[model samples]
Target: MPVLISGSVAYDRIMDFPGKFVDHILPDKIHKLNVSFGLEKLSVNFGGTAGNIAYSLSLLGEQPYVVSQVGTDFSSYRKWMKRQGIHTDTIRVVKTDVCPTAHIITDLDDNQIAGFHFGAMKYSAIQATVVKHKVQKLVKTKGAIGLLAAGNLDDLLQLAKLYTLKKVRYIVDPGQQLVWLTAQHLRTALAGADTLIVNDYEMDLVLKKIATTLPKLTARIPRIIVTRGSKGAYWYYGKKRLTMPVAKPKRVLDPTGAGDAYRAGVIMGMLDNWDPALTGRVAALCATYAIEQYGTQRHAFSRQQFKQRFYQTFKQQVSL
Candidate 1:
């Protein structure tokens, strides 16, 4: 089955501040505070919800078709993705605007403060010819998995409905975009998804909002994964709930794209028809790999290496 990835494609400007942000700000000063801190380090990398997930999935030998909007400046990034074996035919490039850019400043504790300049990404609502063509191809292929990271709400909902009507399995990983969705809209989009993956905070927020409206929606979904950073994740499949431990890493580098990597691992597990417990463990292992890398897409591992790590950590052979 083909993997279709949909979300943002942007450049990440990562900056590291030397000290904790809380040290400089007074709690009582609140709105009257203005401060600037010197950045100890700065670097640029290829990132964004869809790009990260697609890159990780590609590492697992899945050629994911990324459907996202970029700008004229995306040529270099596009070339890199192609070299990585990710299908970029569905990625749209806006000729008149600059690519999306994320300015992220991380403090000593790894807490981040970010500002996003949407640029060409704001035009993501427009349907691209390339995306339509790719979707048509997937329809012909049948049984493709649609992975939605973040995108135009209307477009995502429409695509989800279309995929469900076409019998295509899909996984929804909304990330920060969940804050923008209404309860009813969330229900509609999730109803068609084969799996819903979100961080712990996001899951709590979603559950709180939907509990009053569609109380049974969560139970009706095939699977729901709540990722809890270093604490690991919780996987819900019908009446059973499995808690997976985080894989202990020898060193920590960057946690920026760990969640995306985990999402890819879960998708890989599902494609392999693994159960929820095994899927969560695999996802946790993927996150550990990401945590050991400086940049989101810089990590690479052979299937054998991954299996060895999995067995050493979880004490179980990965089922094919």
Candidate 2:
């Protein structure tokens, strides 16, 4: 059974500003003012929710099948991912459109402002190739696990239902689209998911609208992980809650895709049938790895390196 990754595929342009953004804005005229700041340096990288997760998973020895849409210009990236052992047979190429692009600006304080152009991603709603491939794969494989990271809410929900009926254990990490999901759709996805991962603020919002006790709510779903930046992460499996502390890195470089890295680690540990404590520790270690790197996908690791770091931080041996 293959690990299927479903999400958006986009080019990320990261820019750094020399000064603090607070100095440029006046509190009283905030709503009425329009301003622009020049960036000091810019770097472009291949990224998106699913791509980041799959990259980390590949590093951990899991070959994941990525179901996403990209433009014709993505050939180079596809070849690169293939070399990394990621299966991209299900990725649809939009010949007439450009790939999705995200422009992110980060200030000295690590705050970010971003604008996105959907481009090829806009056609993702109408693409049947990726969805058909995923459905066929699900039907043919037993005990497959799918990660639904990005896409149109309707499409994700429908696919979630289809995969659930086919008996695939799946995790849903709805990154930024949580705000757009309807109450009914959210409930349906949550109910269908084997695991649900989200950050602290998103967890609070979900708790407010879901109207159920967290413990009881998670009983139906096998695992729930809520990440808190520096403090670490919380994992709830039914009534059992395991809190893992964050591993302090020698340096904090970029916080761009740390969450996705953490998700990948958790999935890797789960696949190994490790206990929740070990699982959370694996996630914490992966997060620290990303924190110490400038770009999201620039970090590289050997299995020995991961094991050494894991034991140093958690004081436990990870038996492979």
Quick one: best lDDT, which candidate?
A: 1
Model 1: per-residue lDDT, tens digit, 1-320? 88888888889898878899999889999789898989988889999888999998887778888888888899999999998899888877889997888888888787888888888877753377667767767856756788878766656787787777887888888887888888887777887788888888898788877774223655678888888888878787777777889999879877888999998988887688876778888888888898798777878898788888889998999843
Task: Pick out the ten consecutive residues of candidate 1 with the lowest summed lDDT.
Answer: 210-219
Residue pairs of candidate 2 with colliding backbone atoms: none
lDDT tens digits by residue: candidate 2, 193-288: 888898989887777767666777778888888898998988887888888888878798788889889989888876888777788888888888
Q: What is the lDDT for 38 in model 1?
A: 97
TM-score of each: 0.94, 0.93
The per-residue C-alpha lDDT of model 2 at residue 141 equals: 82
Give the candidate number with the greatest TM-score.
1
